[model samples]
Target: MIVVLIGYMASGKSTIGIILAKKLGYNFIDLDEYIEEKEKLKVKDIFTLKGEIYFRKKEAQYLNEILNEENRIVLSLGGGTPCYGNNLDHILNQTGVISIYLKAQIHTLVNRLKNEKSKRPLLAELENGDAVTEYIGKHLFERSHFYNQANITISTDNKAQNEIVEELVLALF
Candidate 1:
């Protein structure tokens, strides 16, 4: 089966996904990393040089490739994967795909992002102060509909990795 992990930035999708894939004995594919490897460009560079639309197009193309892989995989999709083009629909159409969303509170996201903000292209250039909170709130509100379409949602706010993994296993199995 193909387990697709979707969620907002810093929502633990990648973190928990690796663990889940390991436990399930499935290959782990991080979508963004795959793009970086294939295109020989970092995600931040892709967005900076080619712009979001171009990056999204590449994302869709790579997602199509991911679907064709023969091995079972737990794929960690980029935060905006669902909102971009027909990627979400393509994923849902696959009988083996199990979509999971990692949901986190705005405060929790801000806290987690504060220290690692420099690593993310979008969040790194924020206007400071309440900018992070405002951004997370607005972005999450806009993406909630798409995120909610997942087959399962696991809350990561104030929870340890093990706790989240346990919940996900229970939900998925």
Candidate 2:
């Protein structure tokens, strides 16, 4: 089985996926990192060089590749992964693929992402915490439709990493 972790930026998908994979003895694959390794460039570089349209196409292709080929793995998707192309439909149609959305509040996401904006291409232009909060609020509103389609949804606010993982394990089993 493949467990796919889906969420907005700074929603703890990668962090939770690593721990969940460890607990379940499954390989952990962060789709962004996988893309960087395959493309020989950072995700930000991909956006700067080839552009988001190109990146999204490659991301969809690579996501299909991974879904078709991997097993017993935990996959962490990019923030916009499901919101693009036919990614969400493809994921839902796949057998043995379990999708989990790590839902986080706007304030929580703003607090978590404010310092890390430089690393995020989408959030890079935002100037301050207020800006980040506003961006996330709007972005999350748009993306929540895709995210809410996941087989499971776990709220992550005010929870420890281990607690989230534990909740994930229970949800899975």
Candidate 3:
């Protein structure tokens, strides 16, 4: 089985996925890192050099590739992965693929992302925490439809990493 972790930026998908995979003895694959390795370009560089349309297409292609080929793995998707193309449909239609949404509130996302804005292409231009908060509020609203379709939703607000992974294990079993 493949466990796919889906969420907005800073929602702890990668972090939780690593721990969950370790606990379950599954391989952990961060889709962004996988893309970087496979495409030989950073995700931000891909967006900058080839444009979002190209990146999204490649992302969808690679996502399908991973879902079809991998087993006993935890996959962490990019923030906008499900929101683009037929990605969410692809994820839902796959047999043996369990999708989990790591749902975090706007304040939680803002607090987690504020200090790391420079590392995020989308949030890089935002001036302050207030700006980050407002941006995340709007962005999350836009992305929630796709994210909410996950097979499981785990609220990460005020939860520790281990607690979230424990919840995930219970949910999966």
Q: Give the best candidate by TM-score.
A: 2
Better of 1 and 2 by TM-score: 2
lDDT tens readout by residue for model 3, 1-173: 99999999999999999999999999999999999999999988898899889989999999999999999999999999999999999999999999999999998898888789888988888888888888899999999999999999999999999999999999999
Worst 10 residues of 2 by lDDT: 126-135
TM-score of every prediction relative to native:
0.96, 0.99, 0.98
List, residue by residue over 10-118, the lDDT tens digit for candidate 1.
Answer: 9998899899988889999999999999989999999899999999999999998998764588999999999878888988888888899999999988988888777
Candidate 3, residue 99: lDDT: 98
Instruction: Give the runs in model 1 whose Cα sits over 4 Å from its true position.
Output: none
Question: Which of the predicted structures, 1 or 2, would earn the higher lDDT when compared with the native?
Answer: 2
Residue pairs whose backbone atoms clash in candidate 2: none
lDDT, candidates in the order shown = 0.90, 0.96, 0.94
Candidate numbers, best TM-score first, in rank order: 2, 3, 1
lDDT of 2 by residue, 1-173 (tens): 99999999889999999999999999999999999999999999999999999999999999999999999999999999999999999999999999999999999998898889899999998888888888899999999999999999999999999999999999999
